[model samples]
Target: MRLERAVDDFVVQLASERGLSANTAKAYRSDLDALAAFAGGRGAHDTSDLDLELLRDWLWQDSRSGLAKSTIARRSAAARGLTAWLAREGHTTADAGARLRAPKADQHLPRVLTRSQVDGILDSLAALAATGDPVAVRDVALIELLYASALRVGELVGLDLGSLDRSRLTVRVTGKGSKDRVVPFGVPALRAIDEYLATARPKLAARNSAEETTAIFLGARGKRINSRTVYQLVASLLADLPGTGPAGPHALRHTAATHLLDGGADLRAVQELLGHASLGTTQLYTHVSAARLKDTYRVAHPRA
Candidate 1:
């Protein structure tokens, strides 16, 4: 098959049969498009012309272009996935990217908020919620649930009223790959949610048609909230905090996981809570916790 058409088909399969998230499929599309472009420039016009060497050449080109190691690694993985799929589906006799390799991605510690900083953020949100504006109340509830449950922003925005189990103080969120898991929240989050449901959500929902009533979180126009909106909300919340990592909604998730580990939560349980498919994926929080502990000991210990 032609390279571009083949890539498009592969990405469609990722989104449809494989159930990859839109963001992931989009990334694959970008990476494969670059590969197709590079191959086209070399007079290699079809998937058949793609070989292991060409795949490695793509990685080499990206490295020479000053792409971050993580980005280059992702590109290689993307190519590998596509080529493997092509071979499995009978489009190719061999997986051209089977031997492709890229530098390991640098793992920077995720930003985590201190306990007092979390308390102060919640206090400020609570005070704003007291003003009785529906949006303000909703914002308070949103952040509370975000920090309490460590929900991905996509899961938070995709939530429907029916997803909540009020009696259990838990929410059923559909995470990446359309996997659903019930995540519990604390009393403070429950209180904030109660207030938002009682006073804010209804008010906001009333502004739109009845068809828009199912969403748990609403935008200013009373439609279901978007991930970009959540990013902005969390960014504003973390703007002044001392941090070097991203200030998006995942920062709250990282903070929640680190805090859980710090408070002696079991690692396997935390893996389940965070919806990580692999234990290794969730173990990054242990590193964050250890770093924090080392910093504390350095500051408090009398011995140099």
Candidate 2:
């Protein structure tokens, strides 16, 4: 019934029932632990003993300690989750703190690139592929698949050569929380992968200290390509093309999702491709789609 023991139970519940990522569990645990520590000196040693005023005092301490708004919101959520679980388990008679409020946080719009800009970027990569540099070919494939499939950088780089079905034009990638999904790319990505495997990979492998790496994408040293390298590569490529914003791998992801929605792809299908557990996460793209729609209407409609 102690505070720490309750956190342990909550973590187990999260892991067994909620399927939260380990990092996510750690974050929630930290929030709960801080609350436990805050309430430790007080008489509130367990869930039943805690009160709404105690919860408010904890949040006040967080504010005085200079936690960010987002952080405070998360802590508030942690408090609510704990109380909810306690009520469900019959430790508390009612969810007294359920009505408690959290701080209002700033919202930022996700930046996405135009489809034409993506085409231009891929065209530039195609030129690099024509140089007969197999790595350059692989680079083209990597960029193409990333934009085409809307893969997270981790999902893209974590891919193994064995998981790719070039005949089907699909690659199996494990997304966040180790959930697997099959993502398809275009023929251009296929051709790039082929060239990389046939020419560039062998050359890079021959230079390796070991036999070879199973990584579908290899570095200059013939090991699995890492996330940082992919991020840098995308940034450098976007730098050469003028007027792009924050050209990380995620920008490609946002661009792909936005373009899918723009091109009449169903929201549910795109959600599956993007590995979102909820359609609500996918629905954010609808806002992007609607804004584009309004812009198009303003230019084309004479209804004013």
Candidate 3:
């Protein structure tokens, strides 16, 4: 089969059979499209023309073109997935990318906020909510739940009214790979949610002429809030704060996890709370905690 056709089929299988998220499938598709273009330029237009050398050269070309190591690594993985699928489905005689490799991604610690910085952000949001504006009230609930539960922005925006268990102080969120887990939030988050539900959601919902949305958070247009809006809200809040890296909602997630570790939460429990499939993923917070402690020691130790 044509390489492009095979790439499309593999992407469909990723979404349908493997149940990968749309964003993940899209990323794979993007990388494979580039590979298909590269292959076509070399007159290797069919899956049979694919070879390990071609795959390695594709990665080498990308590296020479100045793609980040992380991006190149992801591209290599995307190619491997495609070639493996092609071989499995009998399109190729061998998995050409079975031994394909790329430079390992650079390890940069995720941006985590200080506890005092988080408190100051919450205080400002609460003060805004005091004005009785529907959007302001919703923002309070949104940020509170975000920091409280360390929810991914996609998961937070995907929440519906049925997702919350108020008496239990937990929310049912469908995370990456469509996995659902119940995550707990603090009383402060509950208070903000209650205020939003009482004074904000109804006002926003009233503006909708269509059937009422079951979404827990509404956009300005009364539809379910989208991830971009949530990102903008977080970016605006974090813009003035002193930090580098992304200022998006995931910073709150990193902050929450690091804080949990600093407070003596078990690695396994945090792994479960964050819905991470791997314990190693959750362990990144321990490194963040250690870095913070070392910074404190450098600043406060009189012996130095």
Model 3: per-residue Cα lDDT over 1-304, one tens digit each: 9999999999998898878877988899999999999999999999999999999999999999999999999999999989898989999899999999889999889999998999999999989988988999999999999999999999999999999999999999998888899999999999999999999999998888787789999988888999999999999999999988899999999999999999999999999999999998898889889989998999999974
Q: What TM-scores do the predictions have?
A: 0.97, 0.79, 0.98
lDDT (CA) for every model shown? 0.91, 0.84, 0.94
**Winning model by lDDT:** 3
Candidate 2 local Cα displacement, residue 103, angstroms: 4.4
Off by over 4 Å in 1: none
lDDT of 1 by residue, 107-146 (tens): 9999999999889888998888888989999999999999
Stretches > 4 Å off in candidate 2: 37-49, 60-70, 87-97, 103-107, 129-135, 205-212, 239-247, 296-304
TM-score of 3: 0.98
Model 3 alpha-carbon drift over 4 Å, by segment: none
Q: Which pairs, if any, clash in model 1? A: none
Candidate 1: worst-modelled 10 consecutive residues by lDDT: 205-214
Candidate 2 colliding pairs = none
Q: Rank the candidates by TM-score, best first.
A: 3, 1, 2
lDDT of 3: 0.94
